[model samples]
Target: MNKSPGFILTQLGLDKDKVEKLVKALDPKTLQIAITDDFGSSFVLSTLSANIASIVETNVVLQHEKDGDLGNGWLETNYAGSRAFVLRSWKPNESDVLEANLTFWRGAPSIKRVVIRHVPEPATQRLLLEKGDVDMARNLSADQIAGLAGNKDTVVESSPKAEVYYDGLNQKHERLRNPKVRQALRWLVDYQGTTESFLEGRFKVHQAFWPSGFAGSSTETPFRLDVAKAKALLAEASYPNGFEVSLDASNFYPSIDVAQSVQATMAQSGIEVNIVPGEQKQVITKYRVRNHPMVFLYRSADYLDPHSNADTFTRNPDNSDKAKSRPLAWRNGREIPQFTEKTDAAARERDPAKRLQMYLELQKIVQENSPFVIVFQVQDQPARRANVKGFVTGPFADQIFYLLVQKRGSRDRGLAQPGSPILAGPDPGIRAVACDAPRASDPRHPRAHFLRAARGRLRDRPGGTDRPRPRDRG
Candidate 1:
C-alpha cells in the first residue's frame, strides 16, 4: 500500500440541515471529527490515526459503497462545489464523468469537462490515441510510444517513476526463512540483463527498494548473478542440489516475462522455479495472505517521501503502531526492534540532514537482511495529442490532473463540440464561438436537480415565504 498526504474534502455550499441529515444517515466511523471549530463553522475530519497507513491501499476510500448504493440519500451524486470539476454519476466498470465549474474555487477549469473511458488493453488504448478517439495513452510501452513518433499531433512524455518491480519471498517458508538462502536467490536473478533486454534500456537497475534519487536510496551494487556464488550460498544454506519453488505473478506483460526469465536463470543454480500466472487481484490476495512462496510484482511508492516507502515496507504493526502490515515482502513475523525504532524516529525527525541519514541507514539495513529481490526502477511513457496541454505523468500510474488540461484552440473555439474538435485557423478577427446551448438535463449540469430542490424549500419569513435567487456564477 502506498500512503500520501494530499487528499482533502470540504463542505461545498450544502445547507446545515442537509449536512446534518446526511451525517446522521452515514456510519459514524466513516469519517470521525478530530476537532470541531468553536464557532461551529467547520470541523476537521480524521482517519483515526491508527488506520492511517491503510488509506494508501487501493480503493480504501470507495470500499464502503455497495452496488448501486451510495451511502447517504440526502448526499446525492451531485454536491454543489467550487472545485475545478464535480463528479457526475458513473456506471460500474465503465467510465468516470466529470463536469467543469466555471466558478471554481481556484479558477475556472480550462476544458469544460472530461470523460475517462476504461480501456484495460494497451493495444486498444494505443489505437485510440493514434486515431484521435482519446486524447492520451497512459502507461504505454516504449514500443507503443515509438510507434506514435511520426504522428504530428501526438507527443510522448517520459519520466522516471518512483517504482520498482521485484520478486518477494514469504519468509515463513522453511527454505526461505534463512537470510543466506534468500540472499542466494537474489544473486540468481539477472537484474542488469533484464533491464537491458526486456526493458529496452528504458529502465535502470535499482539495487534498493527506494528510488535512486530519494533520501533512503543506495548507490551500492551488491547482488549480481554469479552461478558460483549462488551455488556456494545455496550449498552453505543446506540446499546444494537446489530446491523447487513456485513463482507466482499476475498475467501481465512484463511481469510474466520477468518471471519466465528468472525461471531460466535460477535453473542454472539448481533452483527449479515453476511459473504460475493468475489474475492480478487473485495474485495480490495470495501474496497478501502469505500463501504464495514467491511473488513477482510491481509496486510503486504512494508519495514522494521516503517515509511513505519505509513505513509500508519495513515497519510492522507489532513493533511500530504506525504500520499495520508489510504484505509485499513477508518477514516471517520477525520483529526487529532496532529497525522499528529507527524508522519511527526518522518519521518524527524534523532536521532534514538527520532524517536523511536515518532513512539511508534503514535502507542499507533492509537491503542486507530483508526477504526481497529488488529488480529495477520503472520509467513511464505517456503519450498525448499535442493539443492536450497542461498534462504530465506523475509517479503514480493513476494520477490525473485533468483540470489543468486545455485544448490549444479552446479559447478561440470556445466550448468544444462533443463529437468533434475545436477548429482554429489564421483567419483575421477570430472570435470565440460558443456551441449550441446545453439542455437543463445535460449531465454537465448534474447538480441542476439539487439546485431546483434547494429552491423549492422556501421558508416563511415574518411577512411572507422567502426564496433565494440563483447566484450569477459567471
Candidate 2:
C-alpha cells in the first residue's frame, strides 16, 4: 500500500513501527485498526469515515497497477462501489450522466437517471431553471437569488457550508506581527456591512475558526467596524499612523468586492491597504509561501471534526521554512505554540463535553488574538424547481446526495406554494435534470458525483484557470 506515489504515512500521525503494529487485516472483509494516542472518539471515527479512508476493490485497483504501484485511474475511470448511481458518461468541462445502480445494496434509487450539466454562467442557469429546461440551478448570485423571491415556480434552499472566509495578517510583516495590530485589523472589518451587501445570502458574520452548525463553533461576533477602537489599538502598538501594507485577494466577484470594502474600512483607522488583486491561485500561492503582507482567503474542513479546522487555523508545530506540515498558521508565518498545545490537548480529550469546552476555549483565544481575522461563513443557496423533491445539500459539498431526488410532473409542480419547503418526502420514479457549477478533475467516489457537480459548479471555474468561484473547500 505504501508503494503508491499518493501514499503519505504522516497523514496517520504515526511512525512506521506504530502503523505496522496498529493496522491489521484480519479477514477479506474486515480490517482491524487501533490508535495508540488518546485521541477523541469523534475525531478518530470521523477520520475513518473520511474520503481518504474509503475502501476500494483491491483486484480492480490492481488491474490498473503500474510500476509496482496502483495509479490514480480508479478515481475517475473505474467504478468499484455499490453506490446508488454509476457514471454512465462523463464529458470534460461539459456534463456527467449517471445511471441508477439497480443492484445497489440499499435498494435502487427511485430516480432512474441523474443528468448534471456544467453551466458556469449564473444567468444562463437561472434562465434554464426558470424555463423548466433544468430542474435545479446550483450556482446563483445573491441578487439572482433575491430576484427569485416571489417566484412560485422555484424554491431556494440555503445550507450553511463549513467554509470560512478570513483575512490572514502575515506575521512576516513587522507591522502585522503585533497582537494589538491583529486586533486592530479585526475591528476594521465591516462584517455586517459586507454580510448585508455583496455578501448577502452567501455569507454570514463569523468570528471563529470552527464554523457554525458544528459542536465547538463560536457564535460570538465580538468585533465590528470600530474605527476609533482600531485606531486606539494601532496607536498603542506604537503605530500612531497606521503602516502601509499590501492586501492580496482573489480578483473575482465578492472577493474583490470584499477586498475593496475592507480597504475602505481600514482606511478609516489610518491603515493604508494597497489592494493586490490576482487570480485565486496567484493569491493562494503567494500566501502559501508566506510572501504576502496580508491575504484574504477561505478554508474548509477536510472532515467534520472540529480538529479538522483547529489543526490548520491554530496549530503551527514548526515555524521554520523546512517544516513539512505548513497549515494556515504557517502560511501566515504565525507561530502559535501555546494554541498548538491547547489544540493538541483538545484533540486528545476523549470526553465529548470536555473536548467541546477545550475547543471552545481555543476558539476564543484565536478569535481574540490570532493573526487570522475570520470574517464570514459560507451559506450555499441553490434554487430548484418547486416540484423537485428530496434534494439534499449538506454542510460540505461531498455530503450532497441526490439518491432520493425526484422530479414530479408539471401538474404536481403547482402544488408547492411560494416559499414552501422544496425538500419533501420521496415519491417513486422520476427523472431529474440538475445544473451544477463545474467539475472536479479527480472525482473520488460514486457519491461524489453530485458532490463533484455541486463542488465544481460552486468552487472552481472551467478551463483550469484556478480562479476562486462562489464556494467550497480551499
Candidate 3:
C-alpha cells in the first residue's frame, strides 16, 4: 500500500518514523478512495488523501463544515505538486487582486521571477490591461471582447470551456420529491431564451451535465417552456395549484439573472419561485450543506473526461447517510439504483468505445428522471496586451501554460522593427526554445528582469509585421 508521503507528512505533522508506523498499522478500509479517474493524460482525478476520502465520501457535511478552517479542508495544499514554482506567499492585494509570489526552481522559464496577480472583476481587469498596467485579462465578457476589437495594442483569444451552469432541485423538499414535479419544473424553464438573450450567444444550451463535444454529451434540449405539459405533470403529481419554493443563488451577474428568468417563466405553470440572493460563498454553503430547495450554481470538470462528471451524479448511496458526494437527485430523496449501477460500471470500464456508450446511456437515464435542470456550457475569453507573447489559456480556468510565454528579445531578438507585430502573433516567432525542466536557483539573483520586459512596447513600430497568435495553441 504505497501512500503519498507528501500528503501524509503535511496532514499528520508527524515525524517520518511515526508516520510510516501509523500508515502500516491502518486498516485497509480506512485507506480506500471511492473514485479514481486516473486515466492517463495531462489531467487525472484522484483524492489527495485516502484517509480523508474515506470520511468525506460518507459524510459530505464534514467537508462543508470545515470549509478550509479545519485541517481536513479539501483545497488545503499538502505540498507543491510540481517544483517549477515554490509558493512563497499569497494574500489579498490592492484593487482586489489576489497576489501570489512564486519562487523559481530549475527547469523553469527564462522569465523566472513570477507573480500571479489574480484580478476577479472583468471590467477592472480590462482597464488594467489597456492602460499597460497588467499584461493579461481573462474571461472577458462578450461586451468586453467587442470593445477590444481592432485595437492595435491588445488581442482577444477564446476557447470552448467544459464548465456548466445548472439549476438543482432538492428532492427532499415535499413538492420537489415527486418525479413528475421535477420533470414539470424542467419543462417550465426557457433554456434557449436565457442563453441567447441574457448570455449574448456566449453559452451553448446543454441537455445534461456533460458539455457538448464530449464523448457523452447529448447536446439535446429535451425540455422547453410548454405551459400545458408542465401543468399536466404538476396535476399528475397532485400539485395542480402549483407550489411555492425558495431558490437560493449568488449575486454573481448571470446567475442572479438566470434565477430571475426561471422565477418568471415557472410562474406561467403555477410554480412560484422566491429568489433569495446572497454572496457566492454563502449561497454555496446553503446549497451544498443545508440542501436548499432550489439552487443555481455552476460546475466544471477537474479533468477532460466524461467520468469526471458522470460518476458524481450517479454513484449515490441508497442510504443518503453513506453518500460520498451529494448527487443532485439524492438531495430530494429521488432514487434510481440502476443509474448508480450503470454509471459505476461505466467508470470502471477500460475500453474507450464501451466507456463512451456507457456515458451516453447515463445521460439519457438522468435526463428522464433526475432533479438536475441542465443549462448551458460556457466559453472562456481572455485578452492580453499585444506585447505579451506566447500566453495561452485552456478550457478550464487553471489550465494556464504560463511557462511558454516569453517576452520578445528576452533571450535573443532585438527590439522589433517599426510596424512589426508586437507579439500578436500567428506565431511568437523564435528559433529555439529552452528545456522544460525546473532546477534550484540562487534566491538572491532571482530573475526579476522578466517583469520589466512584460510591460514593454504596446504597439507595433514602423515597418512592423503583424502576425496573430493561433487560437488552438492552448
Task: Give stretches of model 2 more than 4 Å off.
Answer: 1-31, 410-474
Rate residue 126 of model 1 by lDDT: 79
Model 3 TM-score relative to the real fold: 0.67
Q: Against the hidden reference, what TM-scores do the models get?
A: 0.68, 0.82, 0.67
Candidate 3: Cα lDDT at 192: 75
Please count the clashing residue pairs in each candidate, in the order shown: 1, 3, 23
- Candidate 3: global Cα-lDDT? 0.58
lDDT of each: 0.60, 0.73, 0.58
lDDT of 1 by residue, 335-375 (tens): 66667767767766756677767778877876777877778
Where model 3 places Cα greater than 4 Å from the true spot, the runs are 1-89, 93-115, 118-120, 150-152, 235-241, 321-325, 387-389, 406-474
Which candidate number would show the highest TM-score if scored against the true structure? 2
Candidate 2: how many backbone clashes? 3
Ranking by TM-score: 2, 1, 3
**Worst 10-residue lDDT window, candidate 3:** 413-422
lDDT of 1 at 151: 89
Order by lDDT, highest first = 2, 1, 3
